[model samples]
Target chain A: MTAIPVQPIVSMRRVEKIYRQGDSVVHAVDQVDIDIFPGEFTVLSGPSGSGKTTILNLTGALDNVTRGDIHVEGRKLQDMSRTETSRFRRDRVGFVFQAYNLIPVLTAFENAELILSIQGVPRTERSARVRDLFHAVGLDGLEHRRPSAMSGGQQQRVAIVRAIVTNPAIVLADEPTANVDSRTAATILDIMERLNREMGNTFLFSSHDPQVIARAHRVISMQDGRVVGDERRDGNS
Target chain B: MLILMAFRNLWRNTRRTAITLFSIGFGLMLSLIFTGIGDSGYGRLIEGASRMGMGHVALIPRGYLDTPSIDKRFDVPSDLIGRIQVMSRVTAVRERITGQAMVATANDSAGAAFMAIDPGTETPETLYFMDFLESGALFDPKNRIGIVIGRNMADRLRVDIGGKVVYTLTDVQGEIISGLARVSGIFRTGVLQVDNYFVLLPIDTLRDLIGYTSREVTHLAVFLEDHAASRSIRSRIQACVDEIPGAEAVTWRDAMPDIAGLIAMDQSSNYLFQLIIFLLISAGILNTILMSVLERKREFGILLAVGISPLRLFSLIMLEAGWLCIFGLIAGLLLTAPVYGYLHSTGIDLTAMFTEKPDVGGVLFDPTIHADLRPISLAVILTVAAALILLSGIYPAWKASRVMPVEAIQSA
Candidate 1:
């Protein structure tokens, strides 16, 4: 009867973000407190207006916190400059969006290499990593295929590989299967799940789909900028 | 690799890229032609003027430059010519006796200025004179009172070679001394001022006619091995003259201030045109890059999502612009060579642009114009155009960097 360790990879304390539109202020994310733990499949489930994406943004350090302390892997998000934030994102965070936004001009291989290239990873290491990533995503021979040439499932898988190629601590997937068929969506999910289990990487997915939520070990449900439910499933599956 | 990426991406949107490149190329061509024509015309004018009596540097009596009259004509020592001859870089020195005179040819008589010089040393400039005879030789150094008249002056006086002309002028003593001169050679330099106003005679004879000793001369013209060394050599020569009484050394530029000013003005105008061209090309390139960034918003977002730094993204976009500009530069150079070559060979006629003939740097040039087609000019223009295009991409690259990955992906 040992307790499972709740090691927080990302922590937010009373964070608030407001958007100015015309004369009124809209609260995109209100004063909230949360912690996302390492090596956990966490789902943020909410309706369209539930500030799910805003929370994801604050977690990823893509946007500045309006009025609170945010620590990612023990690094203070509010204290980082714009360049520092970018470096943090580069070294620590990976993002997969609903659109599977692969660079159209690059093939699957080149798309993955873009991240490592900017990181100044040597060519030999990059090649080996890209090769391994392609094989892991079950796209071994499709490295030369451009986004337009690949199917929706294949493109999403490419994006997943692109995100994880830098060996980031967490993968933030924002409605990653929104544009794919059910069959393709399930395959994408399977690939992402295998990556999380094998790499021991944290996965924070923002989705309202029941299928997506069912796969996560921990679920945090939100409504009106507030978490309404937080649940964790045992290892029994 | 960045350049390769940029080139490939630009080709993805060929029409837009071509238009951008066209703007750059057109600007480059315009600059080349304008600069080429300007440099050539001005260069030739200076060369032609230098070939005349000026010879890069001129020496005159100390106060004679301020007021060049008969009274200021000082007695230069006999050693002056020998000293100037042996000076470093002195290619040739010609002594001339200049004075005002009233002369009556066979048919017409008019008050005019006279320059007496050795015919042997006058060959550098005398060839351009309208009165120069293609058929007959110039007056013998032994001919004391022989003269050469301009075609216009000849027409006015109705005199030809071997014809006797009477010249009357007062000496420095204000006593009218009349002399008879024979026309040795008829000339036409195609310049109206020199042809109509000034006549050449033997230096010795003119000295005798003006009652001047051999030590007296109005000016000495010193030609140099390299005209560009004129300023430094003029300084050295000026130092040498400081040791001599009543002597001063001045460059041809000092002798012709209006001509020197015209050259300076043309150079400034050339720089202005080059600046305008740089701005024009930069704007065109920036517009193209902005459009490309706008068109590929999602792509940039994808790059950002995958951990590409904003600065790296900025570099990629700018690298793309640099490639486009470089392509345009190469294409421009390729197209410009033949066009410049053709212009250089056949020359452009300025008659269509000017009412009469354009006078540049005191030399009246004909309507036919030439251009200098040097590789250095080409390289300079290309480098500048490339720099402008690269600089123009910064703003568009910044705009591209501002694109949020979520918005871009969702919008796409």
Candidate 2:
């Protein structure tokens, strides 16, 4: 008999992360169970404080679970040290945020080089990867431009390039299109989708935007720190 | 690349960068200025005092400097001066007799400390006394009654060169000896102390006039090749003196405790000023770094949101501050060269501003300032400035890295 696969790329088994605020405990992520497969585009949607971002953070290994096991690629989050978590983030996860946190002092190419540089990639290879990512994000000639000089849409595109430049196992995008116009948001979604299909990479995001939700292969609805609905789409690829 | 980025950022925020630079620049300038003034003035004072008849190093009868009594005189051997002259480090050695006396002429009388020297064995500074000849020649040792009067003493006595001056003093036997000497030379040394109360006479004549039977001497004045080698040379001389009976050696610093104390006090004051300047620069740098980091809270949160570790973010802030420090150093160093050069050549004269003069141990104070580009001072300043700037970034960077991405995004 063939052995069954045991764990997903990112899986949280009844995970809960609570924070203490003065006198009361906040259920940032309460009894949340999640499994994100390889090569899948998933979206977690909710209102403010609904624990969508917390779940994404836990799945990305940016935060440790308070109660339950959070495993990424068969490695338990509880067992990982701070350095190991940082390595996991460095080599196993990528992130795109709504604020497009590209280093303002660094140019588009330099910002993208952050992850690659820290991973000890050679300068030649890092430069090539940065140029390719900038081209892929439709910012081919803007590699030398700083984030401050670029428009909101252009900066967001550079942020996407920075997130994916390391070619990690999973990309976590938290409201990546919130800062851009509808047209630019569509293009950003299309690039992410194309990258997902072409590179066979996994992408997971948390957003309340309808456009972001419509583009996902799977949608997980969250309310009050718990998943309310899980829906999968089989077609429209 | 971080350096380049930091430079651009500093230029972009020119006003803020200028404030930070000024903080560092003013600190550098203050240290240079005060230290320059002190170094220049003290150096002049020491050199002036040493050259005014006394050499860089001196040898005196052991207990005579502490309590000068005729009984404490040392009978230096006739061959000892010749032996010291052969030593390579010995520039010049002259025997001298020093005593306190009341000198009088027909019109006036003044109390003074008299230094009697062999005019033939004179150094250039001997000219500070004998060169301003009003009439007759300076004292010749063959003539026991020839004396050179200082200009101020001459004026007080209502006498000039060729006039006769009367001197009465109690001899070593406690008997009063009265005599008259012809004023052979009249001179004006620039120094106030020497011009007012000093009277130069031939050593042999003074000895005979004091009625000493043996070749007993008050002190042996020594000048060295290198002033800094005084301690070692003094020790060597002391060793030699130890081999011989009834001899002692003393360095100029030991010979003059008050002068040494004056230099120590100036050095301590400079150290205190340096510490205050360092603290001021540190506070300024801390304020700038803290403000910069606090302003970029949302930016740092976004960086963490995109998987940049908090440690790396912290390093980035430190690197930025380090780069700023380098800029400040470069600017400060560049500005130092011309200012130091100008001040070194033409010292800031404060004589016009202050009518009341300060004296450092008997030496009059002057404001002529100078600074040398010492490697040690430069290294110390650079290290301190950089450290202050780096230390200023820690708390702000930590606070920045802790910014929550979710909250930052929501707020944005």
Candidate 3:
């Protein structure tokens, strides 16, 4: 008997991105093609200036691709208007920034529930879901604390919980553990790995951290705006 | 949640919000105070003129305004007087006869305005003469030929109280008439024209001297209970005048167009001054809001990345500006209330500020200026404040909405 191929959740075909500064044109992302399957804990690894963050930005629809088609859940991103793209991101994708960019004025619970609020979820359901997620992320008692009052690791955990509280199709985290200590980074990785395993939540990360790269189920390595190595690992190893 | 965010955002920088509030509050306070003082000053000017025998309404002969000759006299309608006297709000109606004449003492001569009034019927308050008398009575019922002269006129003519003077004018038959009259009283109203040129006589004596019959007079001055009710009262008097031939009722504002124009100019200039103040306030608020929006570019980028549309972001910025303006308006009103109350009650005395009281439309003004609070004026000011705040918010909010998440997050 022949095995059926699993359909990818996000597909990129010959994606290219170029930037113009003054009179010079530079290729920030070359014709790179890749597919990310559902429930895959993937990492895009590259040195500085190797287009890892650029690819993350493109995949999340934070920017437009110069020449190529990118689809999320089989919906073409290039065909959407600016407003439509925003709505698509709001409903379908979540993001975690390297800086843990929580709103300074909002408390931890508010920051974590912001995506759910933006999605127009009811107050009661949002409260319940955010509370459960906060407990799961080990930030149970710090719900009312603002970002400035929290440590770097705690802020990132809030960001992580915020990213998944809306039940998005995928989460794109850019250097999620870059600002934390080794112990905190390991904790963050453990939490994200558990969510991926238990809830079938897909996560794509851009990082240069060796620890983050070592835990990924699939690691796509890039050099000079092009993917040089694509490695896939089976369960745990 | 958006409102909560906006309100929290405003206080994130306490000093900036305070300064913005102070600026708005100060501007509104100045506008209120200036409006109050200006209205009070203009109100006094109008009142002074109205009390100086212009009254609230006047019934004049058809051609007397165009030519002040003795031939322009109209016969006084007794029934018309009875009808007007019975009307509500009508305080007094007095007969008057005015003509240009020349008066001479033994040593000097000057041109004078002769005003013939019925002392028996004319109220002293209506003429505003009882309080301003320097030496003698307004008019004595026993003295038919008694004349009242202003202090300045007395000085110019070199005449004293109880002195005899000769007045000469052309009568209705085009014949020259002369009369000898005794000065019974002298007044100093501080109005240059009235003090220098006015001469009052008994209406009956002037009618006889000018060859007028028993019921002939040049005009009828109508006084009202409240000067502000002049427009409605004038309409009623106008209807009565229409029933009588060769009579027309005119309000004080219509009788003195130049003074009315002056008051209008004063109001318009006050509005212009307030506009200038509001412009300055608007600029300050605009600067503060724009700076805040610029500083929050990265935050706006994060908000956008979380799927807040550009329009929503714009609304958030505007909401912040609205909160700032509301705080400012409240602070301003709170700070101004007590000061306004004190000024309204005690008034600002200009007696020490000026050597001579200001005069307009042949009437002397009181030196003390009291603040006037009218509901319409307050409404206008509040509306202007609201508009200025909204106008100041537009550019900053638009700029915030236009921020691109990619560039904003990546810039720094």
Candidate 4:
């Protein structure tokens, strides 16, 4: 009998990104290769300036690679135009940032359902999905409150719900817990883990927090714009 | 949802928004009020000039306007005058003999233009003699050869009311003629040229002096109920008058191109003033929108990263500007309405500004200035302000939309 190999959801081969400042050229993201698969709660762990956020940006098509190929869901991101790249990000991926950047004018429910709205989902369906996600993230009664009225942990929970409400193939979080308290960070990680397990959603996060590193099922460590280690813990470590 | 967001965002900085609105609203009100006053003042001046001596339309011998002499006189039959008086829109028609002459008293003499008017046939509303009568009565039927002279001319000739004066001029056959008349009234029109040069006498007496027949006259002035209808009335009267030999009709616009030019210049300057006001308002709006865009750089980046397109962001910014302009427009109209009402009803007294009635051209303007707002002018001003506000938003919106999401998010 022959074995069938499953393809990775995101593929990067020899990706490089360079920046020119005045008369100096710097390699912000050097030659590197990685693959992210489905239903994995993975962490990219590195010190400052290790190119972790750059790699995540490249995968999300928010930034372009200088000299290599990047494929998200088996399609080459480099081949897309700027508009197409934006559409790709809109349709295929969700993002969580460190600042909990919800639109100030929108309520919690509105912030969560914005992506579904953008996708032209009917009003009823969008409301139902946002309500369910809000419930899952323990934000059921705070739906009408704006970000300014919510606590830091509650805001992050809303951001998480926003990221996953569209049910994209992956959620890329850049330092998502960097601004929250330790207890709030733990709560955020627990919600992410449960969502990853139950809804079969993939999460790729960049963080140096030890608590985040300890909860990840897979940790890819990087140093000086290059991957130094890849470790997988067995059976939900 | 976008509109709601834009509206709410405007009030996030309440002080800034209030200041911007005040600037736009105040500027617009000032522009509208000034424009209304200017238009009303010009309208009064034109109407006054037309009614003073030059009627809205006039009939003259074809070549007489170019060179005024006794030889260029034409006969206007009484039947033609009766026909013109019965025409629609023609209020009155009066015949006059205008000629240059030398007027002399016992002590002094000066060159003057004499207009011989038939006082019995002329309308009191169209005659300047009664309005400016400084002393003595207007021409009396008891005194057939009575004359009315401007005060400046009276001063030049050193004559008073009831004083005897002699007027001399050349007649139709190249013969010099002279006539003796008593000054029945002395009038003072505020217009310097009219006061300095004009002398009035009975038309029949002047005709007898100049050797003209009974029906012959230099010109006939036609008055109209609506001054604005002058051009069309002139054209209608011209069609009939042209059949008479060497007869032509002229509208006041053609008779006084300098006054028409003055009106055009006033209108153009009003438009320029409006432009300046709108530009100032646009600058205020542009500054507010640009600062809002700058402060929301990170918010815009997050929006882009979450799938909102740059074009959508641009529209959002422009929507904000549109809301602000609409608020400002409503506020301005509301604020200006009562002030305009007051000015239109009661008028502004320019007596404090000018000690005497000012004469523009040959027309004297009253000291009380009333404002009149035309609907077309109001619509034009509002439309221009709205357009300028929208135009001011484009650049800031474009700048906001063109920002790269990643760099924006990374920057503080």
Candidate 3 colliding pairs: none
Distance (Å) between predicted and true CA of B403, model 1?
A: 4.6
If both were scored by TM-score, which would come out higher, candidate 1 or candidate 4?
A: 1
lDDT-superior candidate, 3 or 4:
3
lDDT of 3 at B189: 86
lDDT of 3 by residue, A124-150 (tens): 999999999998989989999989999
| DockQ of structure 4 | 0.54
How close is chain B to the truth by TM-score, in each candidate?
Answer: 0.81, 0.75, 0.83, 0.78
Every candidate's DockQ is 0.46, 0.42, 0.59, 0.54
> Mind sharing the TM-score for model 4?
0.80
lDDT per residue for candidate 2 within B191-291, as digits (tens), equals 46666787777777666767764577777777776555677877777766665555578776776678867887987989798889878788888888788
| TM match of model 3 to true structure | 0.84
* Model 1, residue B235: C-alpha shift (Å): 4.8
Assess the local accuracy of residue B298 in candidate 1 as a C-alpha lDDT between 0 and 100.
77
Model 3 sits at a Cα RMSD from the real structure of 4.2
Worst 10 residues of 2 chain A by lDDT: A228-237
Which parts of model 3 are misplaced by more than 4 Å? A1-8, A115-122, A235-237, B55-110, B114-127, B134-148, B154-186, B199-253, B264-272
- Interface RMSD of candidate 2, in Å, is 2.8
Candidate 1 Cα deviation (angstroms), residue A202? 1.9
TM for every model, in the order presented, reads: 0.86, 0.84, 0.84, 0.80
Estimate, for each residue in B21-137, the C-alpha lDDT of model 3 and write its tens digit: 988998999998889887777766776676666667888877666666778767777698888888998888888788889999998988998888877775666777666789987
Model 1 regions more than 4 Å off = A1-6, A235-237, B1-4, B62-65, B70-94, B122-127, B130-132, B141-146, B166-180, B207-217, B222-252, B261-282, B349-362, B373-388, B401-412
